[model samples]
Target: MNDKSQLVFCIGHCRIDPTDNSITFQMQGCSPFANETTKVSLQPKFIEVLSYLALRHPNVVTRNELVEQVWEGNVYVGTKALTNAIWHLRQHLLPLAHSGPVIETVRKTGYRLLLEPEYEQLNVLEDNLKIIEAKLDTANRHMQFILLFMSALVVITGVIVGVHLYQDNLRMIDTQIKVITQDPGSERYPRLSHNRRWLVYGASQPSGNKSLFLKDLQGDDLPVRQLTSLNSSELRAVWSADDSKLYFASHYLDTDECAITQLDLATNEIHSLAPCSSEMGAIDISSDGNYLSYISKHESDKNGGIYRLSLNTQNAKAERLSCELTCNYEDRDLAYSPDGKLLAIARRFSNISEDIIIRNLNTGEEHRLTEGLEDIRGLTWAPDGQRIVYATENSGSRNGFIIDIKSAQFRSLDIDGMSYPNSVSDKGELVYHQYRRQFEMAYYSLGGNVPSSLFPLLYSGGGHRNPDYSTQAARLVFVSSDSGYSEIWISDIHGEKLEQLTYLKSRVAYPRWSPDGLKIAFIAPDDSHEGNRIYILDLVNKNIFALASGYHNHGRPTWNWQGTSILASTSDGITEFYLDNKSPKVINALKMGVGFAKSSTEIVFSRYDVKGLWLIDLNYPNRIEPFISDQIFNAGNNWVLTKGGVYFKSKNSTEQILNYWDASTQQVTPILKLPRSSISGFGSLAYEPNSKRLVMTLDGFPQRDIMLLKHKLLQ
Candidate 1:
């Protein structure tokens, strides 16, 4: 075969003659030269490389020649790209060529096709091409006339179809609601099998460990079977297309690494597919059962992105799919469309904002479906692929919404509690997890009075967090989600005359009163920008301005005793912002939660990597030592400092208790035994000196269960 003869057909296939038989290589669609019988697919770049090599059969192609032909003389294309393409091409070709290797590699040179492919006659191919071209031209003329008539018919049909769809949309979708699992332990990440006979989910035990369980949905008793016995945490169980195997990701407790595994449902056999770091996100299988898509950072990549792997190939490496050079984002919650043409993903740009992006698998083009949504926990595509249902936090509460992709219009689904959409069946049945959490702000008086709820009469449905008192103004400041978003609110010490301070409509946290009670400082996410910034609200003029700081990940802003400077915590370390200076000064090289003692000579903070409290003296910032050791302290909002010592909370085997650490005696003693509850670091703990009162947010027992929603659309 010669290159001149191969030029007869530019975009078709060729039959290569082996020693025993001939093999066909087809290149007509987006995916070129994929083996038809073996069902092995290759990337477009790899196909181009194979075609370039096959055209010049029996001739060695240099690396430079392959790169120039495949990449079209693109100078920026690195050698790694060509090496990867050739490697994949070799893998795809190895199965078809069973006699020996089809692609022969020359050391320090390029690759070549060993088989001599016979070229079809140029005149015959040209004549066949002309006949096909003439038929296509005739078909185009007929299509023009048919399109004109169809255009008129479509105008009338569209109105009728539009009316019918509007009526369908207006029809009630809610039908029967049933609680599937009511175990006291938390159940989440529900997935239904393709056959609709089994339900699988992850449930948390009393020891805070998770395992996977399978429920027989069609059985009379609806019994649940424990599928996995590993001590590690298992999440997001998805079934195989034939319902004979279950795939899930497991996080090892000891090493904190994650791995995807496949479990044969019948024989209970398990196999590991791939291992990733702790930052791995969601996983999904392709509709054809040939590829598995997931998001993770491989051992070689600097950041995590979407990747695809071939299930049939042994030890197949994941191919990166997401392009991050233009906009850096972390992807999660991958859901493949019903037709497998698009992939929907949740992309996180910052701590507070995330967007849903739809990516074309063939073209690598992305279209963002939702923008500026806060904290998207999970999302899934509808069975028809026309709408997307996602769970997000609205006004500090979790809710689900359905959005039309083309119109960008959304409507809320009326399910209660913190709901997360897990899976939607083809019949429109939905499986989700609903969570209910309750927390009350209790006031503890050190002067022998019992604790009570701060505002019993004005208690709202949403959560109230981070309460602080101002003795000078006889008022208290707190963050509340009662206004549909977390906002700063103020009330009198007696729980009267409540008023809202800031209205940024974003998530606000850790509100603290100034020493002189003239201003309030808090942490609020900058919606227009990135990261959480500290802002001060003037009580007299009602003015809010961001503090002068170069860093963005700042929180827990507390004023000094003299009210001349503020202390805040950042990801890098703790910083001090003076009222007179325009820039913040780095106080200490420690990443921890920080607060000043009553005397202002030292600061008490908690180390995240360690288990105890530490103190840094202002007179000697470099001298930081453990203030209290051998105590398991919660990371945030679990401790406060007074003039004498620190009042902190700790959990024992029985319950959580409040303890007092005396500075002079260097001893610790339990002050109060709190109720059995889970303490979230994001909640607040405050202490008042004048009234000797302690206040903290306690999360009551969480009610988590799996719920099933049946609708008319599912039928």
Candidate 2:
């Protein structure tokens, strides 16, 4: 055949003759050919060379023709390179072309295939169609059988899944729950060691002093050991991976400073790690013991954020992470993943809302795991690393929830009531705190000298707090969780004609009555902003409106006497918000809880760090001074300004006293000794001047204990 004819008849698809068990190559590596006994693998250039010769088998090809077609007219590739490629191709094809020599080198020309090429073609479309139809019929039957088998497999899988679901339901219904600590005092922040043999927790005595204690889980008869006796409060203890050391945060009462310390179990010695700036005491140590994660405020900015401390370094220095020098949100309750590849943090956007966020340590990429979650108390990583188990307020109650990280799907566990998830074991055992709080509103008559329950018969077993009395309507507006979620509720002086108002299903705090009693102002979580905003409830119209929205949490809202403006406390300080103009002006830049006097021109607030009550006169510049000193209190909410004096709750030793600071004589006198309950520092107190009655919420019954639950249903 001539060169032009040979080029036109170049091999296309690789062919095989099953009768002789022989295969012929097309464009060598262009098509991959494999069989039970033989396989052929070749390079692209070799495939081209073989194709040029295979199409013109048994015929000699000129060297110029072979090089031009195979090498695409590239002169730089010498004939020796072609010779090497041909040698390699022959070796690869020898096993497959078993009957004869695959290629033979011509004396002066290029090459020739020894085997006679069998070129097959369809002369009749009808015969070709019949062959294709027979093969297709066989393939369809095989496909039908495969589909039937797949359907059967789907049925079997569905049945197995249904049975598993039924068993899981039964397991959930019959979960084994045991109370580990049944003490009358509060026991919280339970942490299990890596081996699950020891559990450490913070236990508060009835005297109100909290200390760390260790319990032996394997032997119930073993006595509990007190790990900390520093007189200061110690909380959130975490065990080292080897269980030889424990790290926790200690807060000194005198200086009100918090420090992170590590304890050596063998030596019974404690070492200080770092001093924290904020009171949000959150810390976690990694499994490898190389780093410690905690929340701290920067020295320069004083804004709280998550920090990582390197233990292996000489100085054991800490560096800010997941944020710049100043973070907008307070990142607390940090938890390191089991693999130590990610960090989970509760980002406190405002006082009312905190959301869980996960950060990739290596990539520095952050993903928000929850949105608009109010009051996240604790968080821990699940053992499987695919989900995060956290404690947050759901339906006005603290509950444990498992959220899938990838899908962001969350479901509340069956457990209820003020649950703080402490730790999760590899075996799916959960150690958490079940908190029970019972507080009631009582009215103390200044003249009658008697305190009685505001609602003697109306008991709902929910928190009643932040009461404000209306002078015009002779009614009281307060925050209550009686309707499953915290809402603004109003009732008469005797708690009759009770009406539920403002169903926001979010945490409502510091409800204050307007001067004319036509409106009530409060702070709640804003769904659109995901932060605490000032909201006003129009009593007449029964409408609620957001008056202010921002990143800062606005609390302790008190309206002016004219009802033209509202004063509230924020992280920055006391802010005066005008009603007509919708403008906020910072009156005092000091961080404190604020309460307006009867005239509204003067305000009384409590200093958090200094533990003093200060008065601020808005009408006069630089008119701020200490009204009462040497008082240990929670926040401004614990104090209220009455026409007679400023009524406040002060901690004396272990007991809290309701003291009246006389407005006329400026003398502080104890009015009543509060009942010993687990009232946290930030308890609610309010006084009505018109009735000469003091309406306050005292911790009537508070019980907290560690609980252990074993279940396989969560998976």
Candidate 3:
């Protein structure tokens, strides 16, 4: 083994600089494996283990040897610590691991480096210094003087820039945050009174229902009063001009209708105002208390719009406000200015891109404030109305941002898990909702006479979803946020040998494999349009390319049997995309085209206005027919197509059942009952033909609480 003092090892395509204890690798033509490169820092012990393995390259480094070398022979601690060291080292070498496993584990012995390594023993910097000394002794003094001057200048410039960045970061993170509610249930939609005497928020009850709770902020340890006891959810409670009554949005679980209600503080009575949309908690009151503004969808409209109802007039009807954007845009999360002259709205163009826009109430003019933003959770205006604070999301990371209405300049609060900005008080205090959640993956057997068997596949600190299997490659691709951001990951069909794939630092989903298994196509957000864009990853080059450039918002993408073209869902219908830059062909009849038959030209799809699965043939694209219409399916993407039939999950009033539609008989048959609780909204499905198993993701109950921030910055 070589000495560990000064050696730079190149393991496959990744370069390890032990001098700095950093590993550098290329991800999308950029590096993110070191402290100077990315915020993801590598553990020093993990690097030591890797360095030991490389020194003994191609030879099995026994567990005892690594433990003695890296952990100083602490048998009890080194046993498990060595295992974790190997795992983290592999994660850092993910780019090279995808091609082939960098470290191969010996079954009963130890681990060996599979990738060949090359290292140099000499230090280049020391060699350069000796050469400079020799040149100075030979009277070549001009070159020495020029090099020393340049070195000093570089040091001075680096110091100045470093100090500036340090100061800027300090200013950006100078906010004090405190979690106000720490109960066991989900709490959200916090509203602080204008006088700063009371704070109101929604909390989950023992019956698994949401209710409003009010706390007196003026006194310590005061009894928190229960404001609402409705069986349904009471959310978005706002205060009136005099704080005498609370106006809130309520959704009935039995009827599934959302409406606004006013609660009288004196008599403890509730009055109905107007009907709302399923998107609850998007209601706000005007400053003068003359009108109530909310977001709701008209029956004939595709997306919801901001609507205003006159609260002072009898028999007042809601009218949709004029939006200066396209028809496909969705307007939500609104806040009224303190003087009622402006309305701040979060407009979503697609799943990936959203922005905050200020709408003039008097002139009916709208202007954009923020652009290319991720999921805007909530928006609120400051008490002075000169600045606005909003919450947005990227992957699983949540951020709180404050923007000046006059200058349009903003900065992040740098507080993590700050999900929703509910309200700001006159005392310059901010109240918001903090949330955290995760999902896990599991598999269920579909084979003979065995009882229902659910096997845990993957569970970690973060979430995993959108699982897809490739029979030809014997690998599974899915999206996981275990690395602190949502990225594509791959593992064996048995959920072993996991490797991270993409580092886009954005939200991605719905990965589908090509027929040849050498490429993968997935859907990621594009800020330029109201729909998500399709990206194709070529395993050969390890590069990602967009499917097409257009305004069409692509849905879940599926590959053709030949793998030359991809069929994706659009607003109107399905469109076929080619790899050779051919013009896209649109088919208006089919909404989401998913799987292809093994030996036939038929493709399974669903329609927007229909209740069941439909199919179309490649030879006859116009001839579309219903494949299974016996019962309404839960969601379009909740089922997977295979050669035998279509395995789908259907929910009744009591339980959710997994059913299969046979290709030979064209009949639906019940297989087994599924776990009703904790199932994700559109629990996506994947199947392995050889293994006869189904994969799905399940979510845990979200942990939410109301948080308060105190700072003079907002003031």
Candidate 4:
């Protein structure tokens, strides 16, 4: 193996100090006294693969060699497993690769370590300690006596400070939280004025229109005044410098237009300032109140990007902040730094993955703050501007995390249902939005005597979604979080004989049954949380294995008609997986494949950089055209393809409607209107061709409100 002995003589074992427990992997050229170091714990398999590659440093090892050595020649398991392990190992090794990739991949050959491996050995630590002990007796007696005296004094001082710090940390960790608004409707994106007395938020009414409401936080029993009565939705509001006006995005339903509007709190007059996005994205005002920023996409652009407009200049157009390098993804959910010098934004690389990034407004410099996160709902800067608190969703659960801007250190706030973190007041009070939601499967029939009725398909709770029905076996499979964790579940059509399949406690979603009904395929994050990958379960043997698609992130998957291969969306695009092949084939590298048509000659899909649904005909694969190009479709996950055409969800001014497009006639018709108070809209749509039965997750007893966090740490 390319002179393994050469590495032994060149760098020795990876020398990590025994006391440094925070460090998992450390490489050469990284100084111990550096201002910051990347600390991450490595799994055993990651270390083994890394050590093997290091032994053959600067030499490409074939794929077969790795499978034989690491996985004991089980190519079926090792093929995609090796790719996943290597991808995660690279992420952990990123901080050390200042010059280049520490592990280099030779295309079509294999991977090799570019840097020499140095690891700590047990014997090395013992020998170093013995050497230090031997030199201790050579010191003078007087100097030794002075050292002992100082050591004892230092110990005493450390104990006193340690106790005080411990108590302070306890208070910060156990911060007191209270629900401020308990309206029956959903209230979202609360904004606290600079004076911390007035709070404004968007409240979803029974009519399905979101209106701005103002509340006096200082008065406990004061009635909240309705701020706006427009027929549009007001989202993501920010207070002016004097707290006399509010700036927010208004999405008009009739004209399908979105604009930045200024609301005079004193006179209750609303005026449109400039055009914005209708996606309920983000809006914020600079600390100095001279500029207003929001996410918008012009007619010429494909995706939303951060745009800034000058409030001081009359009729000033919104300028798009072009991201030439770092801000390359679709940007949303932004907050201005307290000093207005930097902006923290959530950068979405795809539907399933995004992370937090900071940008310098003047110099156009950017730095990534977080990585491998999913569904970043909202983020806000701390009052002092030294830290940021952002909320993200995994499966059905919501979580909050706080990160220090300079040090890049982050920790979970241990708060549940923290959807949109709006603001943190200077007086150590925080206000945000929390949605109390429970999703259950709803069933309906089209032609039967059901009379367009809605009934619960399943009895249990905890967010049931992504239902798939197998006509052959008369079985239905879906994802549910009832066990306090998202897991795969299966039952009959009537929701009887419910059996829990996998106990993977992590987030699981999008379970699809094979055509034969003998197997099921789903997507979940790997152990390292790299990204969601596809896995298959055999009902006959009760065994499970991952379907390696050679990509890190994967979305919803669909089984082909024959059930020999599966199609899914990954980081590369649409990929097809086979039962025997170790490598998957990428069909379309530009679009995300949602599902396959009945004849298997057409694939329904969407794009990351564009809107609207499109179809790819296998006969002429290069030609791509729109499928349902008219009107507004809610989300990609809220649609399904069937023999008739497509059954999708759309929203009007009052409520969500289920619409179906007829393939034969090429016409769109509204089928059913959903509940008006659905905060978290419908989940994945499922339809069985033979029975003409539809199953979807519906929000039940949806409640959302503004919450206040009283903590010393907020200050």
- TM-score: which candidate is best? 2
Q: How do the predictions measure up, each by TM-score?
A: 0.69, 0.73, 0.70, 0.70
Q: Write the per-residue lDDT of candidate 4 for residues 445-498, one digit (tens) a residue.
A: 877764677778877657788798888878889988888777899888778899
RMSD, candidate 1, Å = 22.3
Minimal lDDT window, size 10, model 2: 1-10
Candidate 3: misplaced stretches above 4 Å? 1-185, 203-233, 252-257, 268-270, 279-281, 322-328, 426-428, 448-456, 459-462, 482-484, 527-531, 593-600, 607-610, 618-624, 630-632, 651-677
lDDT of 1: 0.70
* Model 4 residue 26 CA deviation in Å: 34
Query: Which model, 1 or 3, shows the larger lDDT?
Result: 3
TM for candidate 2 is: 0.73
What residue pairs are clashing in model 2?
28-47
Candidate 2: list runs displaced more than 4 Å: 1-157, 163-173, 252-257, 277-280, 297-301, 322-326, 449-457, 548-551, 629-635, 677-681, 689-691
Give lDDT per model, in order: 0.70, 0.70, 0.75, 0.73
Tens-place lDDT digits, model 2, residues 1-715: 1222212111223454433333455544323342223323444455556655755566787777777786655333424346646655565554445566667777876778765544443234346558879999999999999999999999999999999988877655345578888876788888988888889998888777888889998889888898877567886788887889998877777878777778999999888887776423677888798888887763555567777888778767678785654345777778898889999988887787788889999999998887777778788888888888888874446777888899787776777763667567665688888876655666667666455423332466776766777778688887788877777888887667988876565677778888787888888765433567787777664545567434367766777768888877666577778765466877777765666665657766666556677777889736788777654444445777666667777665556677777878878787777555423354566555666777766555667899997655454
- Please write out the lDDT profile of model 1 over residues 386-465, one tens digit for every residue: 88888887555777778777776677776666365756876568888887776556666675656542323236676776
Highest lDDT against the true fold, candidate = 3
RMSD of each: 22.3, 25.3, 13.1, 11.7
